[model samples]
Target: MAATEQQHERALEIFLDERPELRIELDHLNPLLAQAKGETAAQYRAERLHEAFEAEAERLGLFAWELTLQLTAASPQDYQAQRLEVHKEVAEMAGMTWADYCQLHDL
Candidate 1:
């Protein structure tokens, strides 16, 4: 027997959740991951999954940088300012600076 539409959607969600990297692939995944009947469908799913992974990684990186900046924005004393400076330097070294990352990603 064929699976119900709800069944298909639930299965797709489970599949994507198992591979969090593919969550971004939903834009091209037809909401239900569709029925993979042949090679082309498989290839399309793979491509979409890859795109999603890249997008999500970039988003997380930007979010981390923004959070760091907000948390360090209230340094009133000299020592606090020095510590914030050190944190910013470390984040830059790790390639997590908000301005640079956003510019690079065209975001």
Candidate 2:
């Protein structure tokens, strides 16, 4: 079934509850959001969310996109597969084996 706006909002609410510290960032960004209109608001919010995720990923010693995938995956298996795939791609790009890359990153 397709998710509803209310469901999305509830999911966001639950996510915020689990990560109260992010609320401060959200609060800080809300004024910017208020000033934006329509698509601009959506884009601005997406950028801010990406920035927030990037910051958190840095803190956690992970790539921002990787953290995003990890957090947003529909299931544990999905996350695992995506995580491995991303790592493998990154490792190939870096001219390293997956095992070596993981070891270097302490993953």
Candidate lDDT (C-alpha), each:
0.50, 0.65
CA deviation > 4 Å runs, candidate 1: 1-15, 18-39, 62-107
Cα RMSDs, all models:
14.7, 6.5
- For candidate 2, the 10 contiguous residues with the lowest summed lDDT are 1-10
lDDT of 2: 0.65
- 73 Cα displacement, candidate 2 (Å): 1.2
Candidate 2 local lDDT, residue 15: 52
**TM-score of predicted structure 2:** 0.54
Top candidate when judged by lDDT against the true structure:
2
TM-scores for the candidates: 0.27, 0.54
In candidate 2, list every pair of residues with a backbone clash: none
